[model samples]
Target: MRDWWRDLTDLVLPAECGGCGRPRTVLCARCRAALGGTGPCRVRPAPEPAGLPPVHAAARYADEVRATLLAHKERGALALSGPLGEALSGAVRAGLATVRAPGAGGGSVLLVPVPSARRAVRARGHDPVRRIAYAAAGELRRAGVPAHVLPALRQRRDVADQSELDARQRLANLAGALTVAPGCGRLLSAGRVVLVDDLMTTGASLAEAARAVRARSWADSPVRGAGSSISGPASVYGGETRERRGEQRNGPAQQWAGRRSGRPPVTAGADSADGVVDGMCAAVVAASPDAFEISRN
Candidate 1:
């Protein structure tokens, strides 16, 4: 009832810009530009986590972007989902472009949103990430990309609030905290999976989410042993290994690694033959400003 009433009120009320409280508009044009003006780019936390997927973000979480995100997340500015989703869609496209390769299946895209804790959801009366994901799927579809929202991840255990936690502590708190919901693995296999989040800070949550997805996916598959064939985006070609391809030119693996470390951007390709590779990319609307720094390493 709270969410329903909020929706009704939003329709009847004189709106203010979520970003800067401008009168008579839900979002001013200037603030809207701030959300995704510069376009999406690769971002990485300073100390990237092991197994963290390559991530793309639409904007730095600062100034108007920060205020706008908080308004939608904490203050029930539900209408902001549209613009937020638009930003996320840009990031999604950017991430997809980097990982897709030749022979990659152009099937439907699955956006698996990082789940909030049950308590948080109850307090907020809406799932912010999931809400934004649906809007993002709409944006993708309008752009001629088939997309779907797949709420496949869930919190399997309680975690401490991340606001006060340092990077190491945040990681430790989220370790083993997430799991794939039962009966979702088969659906996950149906399309390319891209993890979506509203914001990524230390990247602890995304790392844990990736770990859970990989664990469940590998466990459910019948093919696991050494003889089992495994393929990755840009890692396989006609009768050639990634090493051979790398020797010939900078291949997909190099692009994937380089993107995660904020190295110079390189073109890569997306693949769908393998769930492992299909799930190794993520997108977000915003991230810390420092995350956009180019790493010299």
Candidate 2:
């Protein structure tokens, strides 16, 4: 097979860095540092989309970072997944730190990936986002940080190609396009959910994924003998939010709007109950450099 031969030859052939033409290395030191060397930072898209979850990213998607992501995602550079995954794990950890204090023992963090449409998956020959997520989970576990990948979110319907859409049109196209597989609520309740992606441009996709996860009811869903009732969730994010029966709850769209992280607080005593916040938390490996600029709106 063509694919089989390429894999076999790569093992014996001299390799080149995916990001740069550095010889004899899958990724060079310079390129590696470009991935996430300065630690993860919060990134907000210019003219942020509605319903977008607050997200952190490891590095700016430019130069080496941009090339590395494309190589792994589009070129079948499977060897690059390790470094890419490390970048994503840092973003995930930074996002988690926002909701939980450092050194606080708590529920596991679920790494839920946004699923590609079936048609896209077939054309690519691999699911790049999910693959990176799996590697990221492994990186977290190795460092004693509890995490796992769950492809719980999927396309509930087809969507128009996002390439030609503007920010507003992209948001409209992805609205209501995703849903969680039935019976996964119990698993979601066991820990926090952090949506992971390789890259986030307009953030329309992430917002829709969050809606599908939080819009459905979990109390009535069965998971063996385990179940929980956390009241009416107006907004559940990386941290705790409280709501009671008949009370209006602001969703993630409103809740994440006002917060910016200099030093994120881990909200442990914020709630004693064990449950995933109805709102969502999100992170990505890399984002456009301009995304970090704080807007005054």
Candidate 3:
């Protein structure tokens, strides 16, 4: 298989720091620090676009971080996933904190990665976002919190590449492009869903994905039995629900729907039997400098 061959090749290939040209290791310590520094920060592109979710980026896309992301995403530096995931885990935690709030239930965090285009997956030979999501989940579990990766979101229709478009154009291209997978509605009804991506550019993609998820959660479908109080369309997978904020011992319970002053209000749906219908936050492994700044040029 192609993956089998690629794995075998990686094991035998000479390793070098993906960020710098340093030899003998896939990533050197200094570069690793660069990738992990300052933890995560809230990132919003300048001239913020409509429907954009509050994104937490692990590091500013600069210097070694930029090189490392390109190496893994474009040059097939598969070994970089570990470090990249480590970096992204911080962002995931930050996003969760913002949404869940202090004293909120940490019960179980479900990471839902934004689906990559089939064409892009075929070209890359692997699904980078999913891989990183898995890594991030692993990191979370190791830290004692329950976590899982959910590839429940998918592209419903084909869209043009976003790289060439401006904010408005990008939003138009991604509009109606994503949907929850066949059974994801039930899964989401049961547990918390956090959209995960490798990078946040204009944030149009995350916003669209979140919108699709919200739509499916509200569809008047049959409710299936999952452990969670909220049930939705029947699914083979059982339901799960987030613990009440007051029930948690880790501090104050956080509400995902609260809007920070100066930030646009978070768009959410009417409350259902399950609970509040607030949308999930987005977590990115890294972001380009342009990610925080919209080009006015």
TM-score of each: 0.81, 0.76, 0.77
Model 2 stretches astray by more than 4 angstroms? 1-12, 100-105, 217-279, 295-297
Off by over 4 Å in 1: 101-104, 225-279, 295-297
Identify the superior model by lDDT, candidate 1 or candidate 2: 1
* Off by more than 4 A, model 3: 101-106, 220-279, 290-297
lDDT for each candidate structure: 0.74, 0.68, 0.67
Model 2, span 184-295: residue lDDT tens: 7656655667888888887777766765565443334454212322122212232322222222333333334224432221222122245222334788998877776551
TM-score (C-alpha) between model 1 and the true structure = 0.81
lDDT leaderboard ranking: 1, 2, 3
User: Which ten-residue region of model 3 has the weakest summed lDDT?
Assistant: 233-242
Report clashes for each candidate as comma-separated counts: 6, 4, 12
Q: Given candidate 3, what's the lDDT at residue 71?
A: 83
Against the true structure, candidate 2 reaches a TM-score of: 0.76
Candidate 2: pairs in clash: 100-266, 101-266, 234-249, 236-279
TM-score leader = 1
- Residue 40 error, candidate 2, Å: 0.3
